[model samples]
Target: MSYQLTHPSLQHDRRILLSITKWLLIVGVSQAVQIRLSASERKRLRKIARGHRSPVREKLRAQIVGDAARGLPNTVIAHRCGVVEDTVRKWRGRFAADRLEGLKDLPRSGRPPSFTPVQVVEVKALACQIPADADVPLARWSCPELARHVVAAGVVESISTSTLRRWLTADAIKPWQYRSWIFPRDPDFAAKAGRVLDLYAGIWEGESLGVDEYVISSDEKTSIQARCRCHPSLPPGTARMMRINHDYERGGVLAYLAAYDIEGARVFGRCEPSTGIEPFMALVEQVMTQEPYVSAKRVFWVVDNGSSHRGKKAIERLTKRFSNAVMVHTPVHASWLNQIEIYFSVVQRKVVTPNDFTDLAEVEDRLLTFENRYNATARPFRWKFTRNDLDDLLTRIDRHQAAEPALTEAA
Candidate 1:
């Protein structure tokens, strides 16, 4: 089917070229070998010849047929279509003998597969095994290594790295790459994490938050250092990137305590000497003294199990200072649940990255300036994961953990 071309004028030059080729062929007065074509067949062949995405060989065949149908000699067709006269003759004769069916290449038996299905399975299973278990003394498997191992094991007598790569790619198996993770180790992980998630969803103790109440995700980023470059940094230009000196003098390091009001879209922070009960309390005091929070009915603070806000003592210390405040700790090693860590990540990218500060003062100034700039545009983060998602996560982890030992024994 023909489309309404966006730029019909664009096709005018191509039309002119084809017309000129035809006209030059007609005036030469050489006897042409004619191939008759019905109107529908002629239109179909022209469409195929003009199609932008058509295969090169298929388009060439269509052009040869279309020109032959128009009574052009084999030499003219060959010259304009960029083929030898013998190439044009073959297609023209085939079209004359069998019409459109002759344009297709006849099927031929391809090379036999070098590996059978069972052998492929054996190779893949070997790939999934630890290199130490295979006694190959490698940290992971590469295509070449896998090929050699499989050949030595008689899974295949000989195999190429490319063949192994192709089979692995088709199944999306990459034995060379790995990622680090942890299974939830805390016995009360689900219950503890669920409470933090509830606060994120504006729920605590199974009730919606009140208008005067708030949720705060708080944490400390420790050991942020100020590195004074030995030389002035160079700016990026054409075909180059910004360069900074690797050698530097350490000005000092400090802890940054930050608290993000989850539903309020506000951030309160301060540079501390270090992270401890005292510095964290100072941060709590800074937030508690603010106008809305000072008068807030209840403020729930979500934090991870850091030394500053770890156990019952930290909770008792915080609540004793601010009567309206409530302390909630995320499960051990689970910083992902703390929304303040999200703000910390943003600071890591925008403020602390490259870290070419002259001194700790410059670092502190940059951080405080960024906090104000960030709050101007910050909105409440859309946190959708709930206790139900936590349940699904734990269930999946349980199934995977349960299967691991059995899988090992079976192996």
Candidate 2:
């Protein structure tokens, strides 16, 4: 009996079978006549397979060269190794032509040296010394000035200011005045810092207030002179140059101790002839007793590591009087950690910079007015870099590994 070619499932099976058969035929023929390896290719394969070391690189070289020498084409080797065929061909050609030296990287060409290592050290030492010791005319030694000094000292043969800057950057040598910083290595540093952060973070959210004292964030502008507004006096025929004798004495310079409360969003400032512990304590008392009560059930004060602040008798006396008074001191040289410094910066920009009043009372009045305005709209500060950030950063390096080799530094 003859079978009919009309069954749908049988037709589908026949088409799939034809495709498989065609693919198998092409593979079988292609494998039969692969490319042959040249003599140069065999030498590279032998050397990489035997003498040259570095397990990872050796494995790569061996697989590419050995596969080619075994009569497989570059394309076939690349496909097997999961890389571009051109990469395999390029490696093969280079290894054959130039041997080991060709595989090594070439030195990048650039301008020659202007300063030696010894000379750079001498420059650094000179820069680090006091201006008096250097016998220089300038008050301080800036980078450019230091570069000139190096040339003048006959340390470096000849160098440009730009080249000196480049070397400094490359060497990571910073000569600018830096505040000496010291961290509290106490076991409870993390816990104490966290407590301070938590208190400030949730100051407005709950019943807690932040108390802090800010000294003059700037020096007193003592030499401010008050004079009449400058204008040419008009004659009878011309219009009048309307002017008045500006009040100079009534509004002179005033020194102030600024105390701010985080929850109340208000500042209480006291003007004194100078900033001393007595005025500071008095201001603290006024902040505690006179100001209107904020939402906080208690107040916490955050201060920095200053000598006047660390007076044991004063702190003990204040703490005894106020049941809720707690003082948190930031790590030495870490005053930026305090949020009140940020408030002081704002005061400098808005209140102090615009106009120099003729007398001290004007300075005092301006400070008080600015404090009033700030308190009316101030909001609680949000601090996010928790103790965890610092903890993680400090412990990142693995102690178990051998220390890495020091780099050969350039002048």
The per-model lDDT (C-alpha) reads: 0.90, 0.60
What lDDT would candidate 2 get against the real structure? 0.60
Off by over 4 Å in 2: 1-156, 169-198, 201-255, 263-266, 270-296, 303-321, 328-338, 382-411
TM per candidate comes to: 0.79, 0.43
lDDT, candidate 1, residue 310?
A: 92
Clashes of each: 0, 6
For candidate 1, lDDT tens digit of each residue in 337-360? 899888999999999989899999
> Which has the greatest lDDT?
1
Query: What does the lDDT come to for candidate 1?
Result: 0.90
Clashing pairs in 1: none
> Poorest 10 consecutive residues of model 1 by lDDT?
1-10
What's model 1's TM-score?
0.79
For model 2 the TM-score comes to 0.43
